[model samples]
Target: MRKLGTARPISQKQSARKEGTRSLAKHHHKSFAKKSRSYSSTTAAMAQQNLNSLLQWSTENTVAPGATQPSSDPARQPAQLDPALLAQLLGGPSDADLMRQAMTAILSPEMPQDQKMIAWDNLEQLIESIDNAMNLTPLGMWAPLVQQLDAEESGSRMMAAWCISTAVQNNVKAQEAMLATGAVEKLAGLVLGDADQGVRKKACNALSSECRNFQAGMDELVKSLPEDVWKGKAVDAAEMDSVDEVIGKLREIAARQS
Candidate 1:
């Protein structure tokens, strides 16, 4: 009878211990969830605060109508916020949303040139990542970007080409998608005829990247840059040499691929 009594107490204690452990686990889970929610709220608040600060800075620095143009000197320009800080402040936006914002800012007729430059800079930074570059087509950036290649502004043309080059470098899927937008021909035209040396240079970079190692891209690019065009165009010697260099590189790639 004593033995039975002791065994029953032991069983009860074991059950009580298990109940205590379960309660402790539930308490810890609840605490963690509450902390997670708090952290999320704090991060969201901080993001909004940073955005407001940026807007305030932009507003304060904007040039008024008929005002003197800001100095081009880097020292005289508004101090650039650190990119890492900007990324943190601008966190939580999906890749598509951020990219769309950049494209809109770039394409907006009323956006000031300096702001547009900032937008383009943001876009260039974004496409440096392979994943972001791959997302360009699905995000609907290809058409407008291709169109921007022919923008009247030399800076726009230069930056657009640079963006293309950066995005397609080492990414086969991105190269194929860019080619589908007829960007290769447009870029080739810039390389052959654009009077702006910088535009031609960036276009050459983009042209080289678009077709490298991709046979369909190579064929389209070859058709776009005929032998006659190089010999007949009145481009500067330096510009012609750059295009020739690109041609040579592409030919080498073709020889290997064949």
Candidate 2:
């Protein structure tokens, strides 16, 4: 038979100490698990928040009133509101405009074409708000946003191009204000390669008008128009004029520049 030794309990304090050590170890393990879970939960939460922000920015960049986004389809673009015009509205009520907006909101779904015409009027009002003789700085601030909206959609680009053309033709001060802010470059960018040929034509027409205003400093741009646009489309491809007209004007500017 193997010899057996009897175990000795040294004291009650020893047992208590051993029990306390086990209790401490168990508490430590539980705390560690809790901490791990907290870290994992925080990581998941951060990832979800990032995804949400990206979605928000994507929608905003695509359809945020005046921001520009070319469509996934070449034939379409996002809708636009006149940022300058709307912002101006926020500052004070123009009774006529508010009435117009109410009418538009009510009739837009039922009579889109008519609504579009009224919308065009509203767009003009927005442009003209900047042309107010007293508000030069406000108009200047709006130039970039208007330029951004110019690229957003064809309908909007039409308003911008035409309004600018009218301004250059009739309002010397508005032309000066817009041009000083490089509105011509912005307008040219709006027209070039636009999805709507009409918009492109309007753009060229607007630029041509500005160039004719010899004081606007857009003459150099006029003189630079070649027989063909950079995309190899003759100016007539805009569907607005004959190539001869474009060439003649360019020749005119060339002669003037000389």
Leading candidate by TM-score: 1
The total number of steric clashes, by the backbone 3 Å criterion, in model 1 comes to 0
Best by lDDT: 1
For candidate 2, lDDT tens digit of each residue in 121-202? 4334444443442243443433633463354456556655765665565456666666676766665554544656666666
RMSD (Cα, Å) for all candidates, in order, is: 24.7, 30.7
- TM per candidate comes to 0.56, 0.39
Runs with alpha carbons beyond 4 Å of true place in candidate 2: 1-119, 125-141, 190-192, 223-258
- Which run of 10 residues does model 2 get worst, by summed lDDT? 1-10
lDDT computed for candidate 1: 0.68
* Global CA lDDT computed for model 2: 0.46
Per-residue C-alpha lDDT of model 1 across residues 67-154, encoded as one tens digit per residue:
8764876655776775655766744344455567678867989966655655566677678889899889888898999899989888
lDDT scores of the candidates, listed in order: 0.68, 0.46
Scored against the true structure, residue 14 in model 1 reaches a CA lDDT of 24
